[model samples]
Target: MTEVGILGTGAQVPDRVVSNDEAGAAAGVDDAWVVRKTAIRERRWAAPEQATSDLAAAAGSAALRSAGITPDQLSVIVVATSTPDRPQPPTAAYVQQLLGAVGAAAFDVNAVCSGEVFALAAAEGILTRRGGHALVIGADVYSRILNPADRRTVVLFGDGAGAMVLGPGRGARVRNLALHTFGELAGLIEVPAGGSRRPADQAALDAGLQYFTMDGRAVRSFVEDRLPLLTKQFLHDSGVGPDDIRHFVPHQANGVMLDALFAELALNRAVMHRTLTHYGNTGAASIPITLAEAARSGAFRPGDLILLAGFGGGMAVGFALVEW
Candidate 1:
């Protein structure tokens, strides 16, 4: 079997900076309260003209450049996002057009924040059979779906995109991958309206169901209970131990929760990468964005073991091991 690996990575965040005071103003909170809860001081919000596809394309282009690959040479373009540019036509289609990846097949994956790792697993399978490079992008425009008054969701999110180029080339060689979903807990985080089950009608709009919502308490509990167990199992199954991981790139969820979880995992040798302090939880884009930033900074040493984890809506969790 041909080995699949990450060839390059890139990330793009909007220029608009929203401080804690700004994000919490409408929700009756202050910087102190927000920081105590999420450890996020500021985040980037998209400009009025920017959408998910635009960011995705920019990150994709950067990833391609880093990989020394051209757009036309791509065999697949996978965009992992919850906030698409539109309901119709996948966001990856727009990204494909923007990058002039005319030869690539494009699509979108909506595992919420877990979409990036899911997309990576999907693209890896495709490339193993097709023999060409794949551009996997994780992008979201959470500013569009957030309800200003709902601090639970609004204060914890930002808009951004991250991308990785994967192919049969030198980079971070993928060693193992795992994904799990607990559908029974789907209601823990979601948009009540906009889907077929609950159309965005006047009634829905009147009730403010179009905005994102979450049971923060329940989500925290879910991660606390499941993440450590799953992560251990994943590492064990891959013939590795927690101490063997050199770097851990987890979903940029809540900084507080991450801190607790990291301690519980006790990956003594791993450096946990985090970007939520400045970028907030950018849904699917969090992991890739953090990964790209770390890679660009020359953080990984050759033969280092990197573990990527993502968990979010659909009550999904994804893990992948890479040998750099």
Candidate 2:
């Protein structure tokens, strides 16, 4: 079997920044309240003219450049996103065209916030099977789906994208990857309409059903109950322990949830990397964006153990253990 590893990473956020004061005013709250609740001081929102593909392509191009590879060298392009440019074509198709990846296979993966890690696992499988480079991108334009008046969901999401170049060569070796889903709790976090189950009709629009919705308390409870078990299982399967991990990059959910997770796992807070304070929750893009930022900051050393874990709206959990 061929070995697959990450060669490079890149991330991109829209030019527009939304500060907590701005978002809080819209939510009828104060900046202090917003920070106290989520620990997000500000985040980036995509311009009206921009779409998910735009962000994905920018990040993908950067990743390719970081890896010193050309578009033609890519064998596959996997974009993990729920917020596609359109319902007809996969967002990956538009991203591939924009990046001029003419030789690569293109598709989309919808694992919501756990998307990037899921895409990484999928890309690794493709590379190990086919012997070529793959570009995996996770991008989302949550602002488009946000109900401006709905503070809970609107204040928690932002728009951004991240990408990784994976190939069969020496780099961050992917030692173990795992993904699981709990469909029973899918409705805890989701867009109530815009899908086949409840098409985007005037009634849906009138009811504000097209907007994103999340039961934050329920989500936290779910995480508290599920994450530790999942982490234990993941560590066991990978034959590694918490102390062996030099860095624990989890989904940029928020400060409170992350703090709770750190306590639940009993891991050192210093080893945890978080981007939510500045970026809010960029959905699928969170994990990779944090990973890219950390890589650029010289956080990893050779032979270090890095753990990537993400859990979100599919009620999904995905993780990867890498040896840097």
Best by TM-score: 1
Candidate 2 per-residue lDDT, tens place, 223-321, comes to: 999999999889988998877888999999878888889878866533888888888999999998999999999999999898899899989999999
Write candidate 1's Cα lDDT for 1-324 as tens digits.
Answer: 568999999999999999999998999999999999999999999999999999999999999999999999999999999999999899999999999999899999999999999999999999888789999999999999999998898899999999999999688899999999999999999999998999999999999999999999999999999999999999999999998999999999999999999999999999999999999999999999999999999999999999999999999999999999
Global local distance difference test of model 2: 0.90
Question: Which candidate achieves the best lDDT against the true structure?
Answer: 1
For candidate 1, list the clashing residue pairs, or say none.
none
Instruction: Work out the TM-score per prediction.
Output: 0.99, 0.98
Error of 1 at 67 (Å): 0.5
Residue 125 in candidate 1 has what lDDT? 92
What candidate 2 gets wrong by more than 4 Å, as runs, is: none
